[model samples]
Target: MSNHELGTVQVYTGNGKGKTTASLGLALRALGHNFRVCVIQFMKGSSEYGEYKALEKFENATVHLMGRDTFVNKEAPEVEDVELAQEGYEKARESMISGKYDIVILDEVNVALDFHLIEVEQVLELMDIKPKNVELVLTGRNADKEVVKRADLVSEIKEVKHHFQKGIPSRKGVEH
Candidate 1:
């Protein structure tokens, strides 16, 4: 049940929800086995999320929020957005190289890449340098084909239906 073996690259991407949710679910499972986990959230720095608050209960987990509460324009991202994402990426890469965590989840990294905040080649290079036992997870919509091609496992969460279409806002403990 423990992930004590070689860690593989896992990607969760698509035009749907549950990408970050799925990665966090994995993090929770990893914690059950006493694994050290780091969650670096990109473009999602709001402290109001229930998950962010709940992460305090896990002693072996660390969550880094590197974004503002404001929305970022994908077509033309602001300078501050780019800077924040770059900082997040640097911290994420450092964490992975330090061998300080068993699982490193770069939440919303794919979106950052899609918005041109980071380059695909940069991520690809990081994959090459990752520690053998470090599990690297990238989550967000619009994942590059190159990323999918390099990952060991790729799960696309297709949007079959969503409450947002029904005018239901994000609820605490569920969508937040």
Candidate 2:
């Protein structure tokens, strides 16, 4: 597995928006270069991301979405949502091991781990077990430092100012 030139694993973390967007951008760029891309979106069930929709038109990209439409919170956590996220990660791990994709985005995986539905140790183990050529990405706020340390690039999107805090609800195409 170490024989091939390894790709990078990145962390897109912080309180601001666009964590998944950043990863999607990477996927898009990879796809442009004829790289096969796979995205496993956690915390998102039937809803669609515009990037996913666009990528679906291409023959090279595939998206596996798992989750219900619900927000995560400390007070009233979505137990089922987190469970589904864990299941998605299990499938994601399988895909990573299979070496079918040039790049794989485990979108919102960090959030699932933070909620205690997914084990951080298990993810770390999976990282070690991944195919070297498959560039992996884990996105969401509050990414573990251990995970970040293991990443080749770590970008934290600090929320200096956001329209959401200004009472702006999430809009289609923009937020989706």
Q: Give the distance in Å from residue 122's predicted Cα in candidate 2 to where it truly belongs.
A: 1.5
TM-score for candidate 1: 0.96
User: What tens digits encode model 2's per-residue C-alpha lDDT throughout 106-171?
Assistant: 998888878776888977976788777889899999898899888889999998899977899988
lDDT of 1 by residue, 133-169 (tens): 8999999999999999999999999999999999999
Q: Best TM-score goes to which candidate?
A: 1
Q: Whole-model Cα lDDT per candidate?
A: 0.91, 0.82
- Model 1 regions lying over 4 Å from their true place: 1-3
Instruction: Check candidate 1 and list the clashing pairs.
Output: none
Clashes of each: 0, 0
Q: Tell me each candidate's TM-score.
A: 0.96, 0.90
What's the CA error at residue 135 for candidate 2, in Å? 0.3
